[model samples]
Target chain A: MTTASAEPLLSLRNVEVVYDNVSLAVSGVSLDVPEGQLIALLGANGAGKSTTLRSISGLLQAARGKVTRGEIRYAGQLVNTLSPQDRVKLGIVQVLEGRHVFEQLTTNENLEAACPVEMSRAEMRSALDRAYTFFPRLAERRNATSGYLSGGEQQMLAIARALMTRPRMLMLDEPSLGLSPMLTTEIFSIIRRINREEGISVLLVEQNAFAALDLVSHGYLIESGRVVMHDTATAMKNNPDIQEFYLGGHGVNFRDIKHYRRRKRWLT
Target chain B: MDWILFLELAANGAVTGLLYAMVAISIVLIFKSSAVPNLAQGALVMVGAYAVLAFSDWLGLPMWLAIPAAMVFMFGLGIGIERHALRRLAGQPIIMILMMTLGLDIFLRGITLAAFGGSARRMDLGISDDPLFVGQILMSRVHLTGAAVALMVFAALVLFFRTRRGIRLRAISNDYVASWSVGIGVEQGVALSWALAAVISTIAGVFWGAVQGVDQSLSLLLLKSLTVAVLGGLDSLPGAIVAGILLGVLESVVSGYLDPLVGGGSRELVVAVTLILTVLIRPHGLFGDRSVERI
Candidate 1:
């Protein structure tokens, strides 16, 4: 993270997204994930975190969403206009907010499905081995139908499937959403290893602020469609506003922060 | 009881059942890949038969050349339709897309009627009209050949899903956005699915036309396949085949024996009752996935 390169791996400058032509989802949210860095994007529900990840991966367009403004750069190239498939080929893959693993497909088949059709058999075999190595639990149930997997296992399969794509930068939304506390800790440890051992850059979006802060060194906090805070995870954790508001702090100023309502619709 | 006649009718039922399932499989293929209900499937079959007629009966090409040419033509037509018409309508409501295909069905049926006229057309696949017998029962070569083809297609489909391309198709079917996130060309997958569905329909057309003779009624046969699709599960390939053959056998046996006592054409009733029973028993279809993902 402290490599201090002139350009970050991914940089979003004043980005704005709107869905269904009229509903303003988010605006002016900007951050950068440096090479080999684990960066967290923290926000509550409807805080536009998932929309930002989807926008970066071009899934917004697929869902009738458009990035009407701002620059999204991935691997130092402007990528707001790219298709989701093309963005993936350029080494950015998003594990969508929910565990969107193909439920009908078997777990092993799902991994193979994520691979490009052009992948060689040997290469695919190794990719499967790598994924299985990352989550031994997934390896145990490799042939089971994904619909039958437990919530935590389904989340693991989703990330393992994304990993099978061999992405350079992995963006995960709500990795700990429905997982048990122990399972969440276990999953985050593997994520850390994936980032550290494999050197894959991570951009994690989560509603679980404490868990996200524990893993990522740098963080961006957006509330109501705009970036309200950006700092190192340490700074974010110690900040009084984030502590009193997000870190389960007591309710002396709860009513006042609720009215911090900056309805900054950026795409207009 | 005239048990020999009953056995022969049962054999005929099996053949007809496979053909009916063939059309259902085509429906399932398109529906599974893109969630687009291809209401034009039967019309596609009719058009395919007409193409074979144009190539063989009109142009005097042999069966060898005529069949492949018609299939390739249908494949291109399918991809072309997807590219020009359905591609732009991506993310539209399912009902809207389904209606568009219904429109396509009428349009294609009208075109076939204009192009080939309302007269019946026959295709000589050279499979011969001779009846093959086992023990006391007799089976037509045409039905057996068509059934064999259907079985082979089923096998090929299983093998296809096991291959990387097939797995990707399944992935796309399972989750379109998720598939795209992992580097799949969703548009291309949808188009390819249409093309495959077209090819299957054309083969069914060729076989059905060979038996029933290509005419306006060939397109209406989609009603039967639709019945099979719903009875089997629109998204289940194996379910389609099983339902197709089951309905076919039921129709054959009932019309053969029960119809004489009941005074004609209760096969439709039997199919309706069976479909109702299937719905009551397994609403998701015999082999369909239990529930699609909500999110």
Candidate 2:
């Protein structure tokens, strides 16, 4: 993974979030991400990685238990008080974990729904064309209801929908979750391609360190509401600490685990 | 009833039905935006009629100027209601807001009674007051004009909702959070819907006043509008209008023909029956969105 030669695009300093009065999800965490770089947030279940992402996006208000005691700057602006929509307008878009692409809308309509380019309809049409070029599967199933799309295809649609907003940065929560290995590979490969070819900065939060670190330039390991380690993907991958705790170590990849096959597996 | 008389009564019922449909359409617009039934809608119509009458008689505005002026005034009044009463109650219980608007209706009614003395005022609106004889049957020229006005207004509204502004309103109604995230001014959109509904209600009231004469008793018209909206669907604008006319026609036929056996006053009975049937069959209304529960 090669780091981009540019100033940091997003920086979080000692950010803290506490739910209710008791649960401390994230505490005093900080990280800097440069432009056009893919950064992965790795942790186990309930690791506060999602909470950190949510705080940056302004979805989880600091006034709530999801409070931020430190500074969060995006493109050199303090965005702690900005609303989620304002954050989105300012080129920070998050695809929620479950790929909740407006289920009632058609695939193309769902893509069209997030369109923030307040230009004439003609401009919007060209934007759609560019988005379709990236995700041809969505273009093919343009008229189909989004609910009918497979998990993989819906993930692609979510990415495409975020692209329509023309964001400089994208925060995706577990793009590979609940997806088949082949689908996961395709999703990450496209994300890597988007980062390399299109210069779009990506901040991805995933439990699968193997897949997430495969594309990220740097990785932040969160454990119990704190960043246990922050290093380059190469360093983190090779570090014994990450392998011992986060991953089951021994380079034992979950993708290689297989069992006896049955004929015609159920999709669900 | 004979076929000849049946057709005549049906036509008459439909003309009146158009007026009720127009009123229901006003209610539907407000309901979609605010999720409130807007009890003042009937009062709004009466206000428009009174405004017109007052302008022509007291203020000396001509018919052309007076009508538009009344419409504009009602539009302001509608926005004022939203800002003063409804805006504070946002996100509150639906029944609480309903009661609040009901209180508004009563307040408006009291003002009209105080100022206008509850007397029906005759106006020379210059519209055709003579009934046109269609062969043996006679239909009032005013009812015919009311039907045409209702149809034209309905068409215009349908076209407006199909436009960008209309899509914006529907989007706000469907998901307020999503609409806000998409850079839509939700407050402005809701206010615009209320204003538009107020304009429509005012026009309906003016037409009703011209046909039936203006009086404080006209506030009962909102009851009919409520019935129309409930039967059609709370969120469906087209449903409100169509259900209104259908209910009107049914009431007409039932009351004219069956009133003899039922001892008259069957229109109210017909509305009650339609309300029960719609609630049982489609709780969301004929054209309202289906409530999708999250798992």
Candidate 3:
């Protein structure tokens, strides 16, 4: 992380975090993300990838787990003292894991929920129209309740809702977790477009290594709550260790076998 | 024993039942939104009655002016309770929050007693206190008006929830994490829910005071209303209204006819029996959802 040439848009310096005393979720992890760059965080199951994002979002109190180490700076401000809501107001938004759409609310209502009142009616309408243009499926079901939407439509609605906030940097967790291959590719293209055209920085966390590597320019590989490798996406894609542990040998099909097992275990 | 006497009592019971339903609706609104059955709700009703009496009778203000003013004061009180107390203890156990509200009930009651003094004052609505006779049954003009107001409020609330704001509130109540990630102002929605509940409570207080006379004893009626809500379903507003009316009719019947053999206060006994049976039959209440745990 000590490249030392370009200023990072968001940087985590020597962060240490522990959860429940027995489980050390993250320790001595440092990450540097530049402005308008799409970076992927690749990790196996239980490798502290989710914990890192949670800390960044201020949803999980790092103080509770003894930061014991370093500071997180965003756009030249020390954000460790700010609450989750304050972080949101400061243009940092996280699209949480699982399509966390307000299921009882309509698609349009859900879109309007995250919208700050700062935008004028015309501006809001344009932004809303842009979202509808991006996902016409959501537009078709604009007044429909979220629970009734198909899983893919719900995911689209979730992303659309987050975009309504007009975030400077969007952090997405498992965007393609359970989607079909075609849907996964569609979402990846949108992520790439957001970074390239919209100039919105993306901090994407995904276990779909093949897709993530194709999408992100640079990335860091984490294991057991520590960073084990860091390089360009091309280098990480070629790494044997990542392929064997996370990518299921070929790294082509990321249908999430472990998730299937986990769900099965719960049912049994 | 006459049919005319039975009909008269039934009409009176219907009016009183409607007032109880309005109060029960308030309890359901707060309970559904915050998942905290506000014990202080009864105290809020007593405070509302006292506010109306002080403004209209003591301060010599017109009833029209005092009504909205009393509701505003109660709304402020509700917001204050949420900001100073409930918000801080957001994730605490339900029992712990309920206990805190119970303590709040005592604190509010003590304050009201200290301020208003310990005497029953007949609150004049400045309307005709005369009862209208229909057959052998007589109903007060105030009671009839109270019924109308209660009906209108419930209708309005039903429509409000179907609107955008109401949908947002219900979404938050159903799942807060989903609501928050969608950028909903969940904390604000929760506060607004409490404020709305307080406004309804204030209206209920005014009507109850008109029928029973405003005093410290007004708080006792809250218990009966609470019992009705619990039986009807604490989460269902319509259930609360239906249960309130049903209980009112049942009590009136017992007192009017069966009391001769069972002795007076038999109505209370019947409510107690019904409460026990309801708990056994449907612990979640008649309209409440069965508990569904997420994996």
Number of the top-ranking candidate, with TM-score as the measure: 1
Which pairs in model 2 have colliding backbones?
A18-A65
Off by over 4 Å in 3: A1-6, A18-24, A61-69, A119-121, A250-268, B1-14, B133-138, B158-167, B246-257, B291-295
lDDT for A250 (candidate 3): 48
Flag regions of model 1 displaced more than 4 Å.
Answer: A1-4, A251-268, B272-282, B292-295
**How does residue A251 of candidate 2 score in lDDT?**
56
Fold similarity of candidate 1's chain A to the true chain A, as a TM-score: 0.93
- Alpha carbon deviation, residue B77, candidate 2 (Å): 3.8
Q: Compute DockQ for each candidate against the true complex.
A: 0.82, 0.21, 0.33
Q: Model 2, residue B98: what's the lDDT? A: 87
Each candidate's TM vs. the true structure?
A: 0.94, 0.81, 0.86
- Per residue, candidate 1 scores C-alpha lDDT tens digits across A155-263 of 9999999998889899999999888999999999999999998999999999889899999999999877888888999999998767766787777564656544432
* Residue B212 lDDT in candidate 3: 81
- Quote the RMSD, in angstroms, for model 3: 5.6
lDDT of 2 by residue, B51-99 (tens): 8877878899998888888888888988888888998887677788989
